[model samples]
Target chain A: MIHPLAVSHDFGVWVGALLTLMVFSFLYRDNPFYKFAEHVFVGVSAAYWMVIGFWTTLWPRVIVPLIPEASRIVSSDTPLPERDLSAVVPAVLGLMMLSRLVPRLSGLARWPTAFVLGTTAGYAVVRYVRSDFMHQIQATIGDGVLIPAAGGGWNVAESLAALVTLSGTIFGLIYFMNTRRGGTVTTPAARIGLLVLMVTFGASFGSAVMARISLLVGRLQELLGDWLGLL
Target chain B: MKRPTPQILLTGVALILVVAAFMAPPGDGSSGGFAGAVTYADRHFSSWFGILAVFAFLLGGASLLRTHGRRVRERKADWHYSAVTLVSFLAVLIVGFLKLGGPPGLTGDPTDASSWLTTIFDSVLSPLHATLYSLLAFYVASASYRAFRARSLETSVLLGAALIVLLGRIPVGVTLFRFDSLSLWLLKVPNTAGQRALMIGVALGVVALAVRMVLGLERGRGGDGS
Candidate 1:
């Protein structure tokens, strides 16, 4: 007996490492392996999401509501929840969203589309105004450019930083507001604003790059340390 | 003008929500009549959105099958890829739904201890996603190298800021230069300032768009143009 293909051999570790290699093969140039992996990724990921949605959402909200008996699947000993007829509204709307497949009733799809859009827009406006506009401004400069010291005196360094923050914010707004394209409508505020915005975007992108670097490091660690048994 | 059902619904739904926003100032659970009703409606609408998302996923699955199935049947270029996609999709979907290898039960757990779907996810999906995302490191580095040429004052500031931020994240920068605090200051002060400005602008734009949608001025969004 070969001891079931050796005690140390693990199936999943090998498959994961190979899949990682297949995807990385694109760095060498596009090829069949990369394409195959890409397709598999797409298919598997979509199916995985669907599975999650079924388990997390549809199974509970739709199935359990429609067939209260389905709740027993969650646990054999738990009480069955009350049957709710309201679940049918969402069910119908959901089907309506997919009516685009048919030629004649394709227009029926608009109902759900409109419903989602309306609700989202309404929801978003309130959130954006409250959080983004009102709260952000209040935190940024609503108390004036005075960073009060713990003992009630002005902390010069903190106050300077606060002033810079206020000025940068106002100038950045100036740049965005002054969207005219020409030879030179560039006000001093806009010029300063442009610099601030660039710095901001650069810092943001740098954070993203660092994130990717961490992921790369992690993937490499997995390949070398876990799969190859080398740290 | 011809088809009006979706338009009417869009107007009505948006009006209700916007009206609720004005009339039912949040934390008004104590205020008994209309405000309470509006709050309840708002909660229901959010729930409805979530419920629709689940169905939308199923719809997306159907769309994927139709698109790929056609390509495979028509013997389109690289139809084998489509075949692979279809096989993988069906295998995962079926195995997950059937709860294959799970404890003799109807619980729809895709990651059941002995499940094939879980095996596929652990061995296949996780690595693929991590590897794909990690590939961005090369792309981002190369793109930054090209873009950070410092042709003007703005680009120079961008280049400097990026380098400072990047160096701040590395052990050498922290050890030799004490660049970490400088980078943190840059992120905290100026970054916050710019982001807040942008957020305010975006909030205003959203309010405008929302109002347009409510008034049915944004009819093009409804694909039927109703």
Candidate 2:
């Protein structure tokens, strides 16, 4: 009595439930179903990204403007006049990206790839040097120096904590410096630096965990509101 | 050492194009000038590339099938898992591509919740992804308890700062101690300072790595270095 499509929908819902449960089963133990879901997840996500990149990045940025009607008019305020052949360079570069699929032509893709890498690297370097290095140094020096409170007598705890943090930051940086020599794992200074690094990593892990839990809570709220209508 | 013929040629061509695009004298015409011509070429190229990438999804799908199919055919012990994977994959693919249970006519109405693809993806895949990600909470708590220890003076200071910040972030901390001032101090001063220092180090490392990559000094290309 039921329509064929209705049966298909029901079947799909059941399959989806099974997959969801299978993945969740991982909390209890590793199993075949979890692996299957994981692989499928990877495959689907990769395909989704490639599709999105083409539609969002390539199509809009490169393709649409090529149409005569879509071309922008150049005026006194405009930076550059329109050009037909300008698209050719990017087009060739995009085609070069596909060259990786073919063993022989894969090398051809490197030119476009290198340009992208080089530009990104250059931008990152300048941004990092200004924002990360200079800014951090200025901040570390300017603040966190303990001064006497209105009541008088040194704010011992605050002053000591600040000193320790400043020291830890310096030691951590030194630990990472590849050029430095004589600071081996066994040395007292090296051991202290390593300990600081470990604590920093631990704190990062804790924060990351909190972030994930927050995301989970958000998703749960959506499910409750939409599916259960419990809002 | 084969002379880098392809690399040199590609780089040269890219440089010439970039320079020409930038330096060519401007013209008065709206769409007939050198700029317009270049723009046209770029757009058409982009559309073709987009189309190529879209079709390439089939290549990916085929590769997935082949890999999984081989395992199933070989009758691997866990081949049943492979079977489930292929079935689920094909089911999603068919539902999406065929637009199964889509609107009666061919208007391409994605809003139709009745569509099997929408129903399956919305009800199933979305929640599954979220659930998997949520499992990290337990692991994180266990890791933190074990790792956050105060064995020395420096460590005690680190732990103390972390505890203050942690309590500050939660509503319970604010309600219990009314120590908003202490919490804010921990975050604004120590947390920010530490984060900034780490960022600087990371930035320096990134710049050095990037320079190496550009000059071909860092050949990240596959396989163990010979």
On lDDT, the leading prediction is 1
State the lDDT of candidate 1 residue by residue for A87-178, as single tens digits.
88888998887887777997777788888887887788889989989998898777788878899899888888888889888888898877
**Model 2 residue B6 lDDT score:** 39
> In angstroms, how far off is A197's CA in candidate 2?
5.4
On residues B112-186, what C-alpha lDDT tens digit does candidate 1 reach at each position?
767777888888898999999999999888888898888888888988888889889899998998899999989
**Residue pairs with backbone atoms closer than 3 Å in model 1 (clashes):** none
For candidate 1, give the DockQ: 0.69
Question: Just chain B of model 2: what TM-score?
Answer: 0.65
lDDT string for model 2 (B64-124, tens) is 6777789999998787776766776776665554456767532333336777656765666
Which candidate ranks first by TM-score, i.e. highest?
A: 1
TM-score of each: 0.92, 0.63
Error of model 1, residue A113, in angstroms? 0.2
Q: lDDT per prediction?
A: 0.83, 0.57
**Candidate 1, lDDT over the whole model:** 0.83
A177 in model 1: Cα distance from truth in Å? Answer: 1.1
Model 2 lDDT, full chain set: 0.57
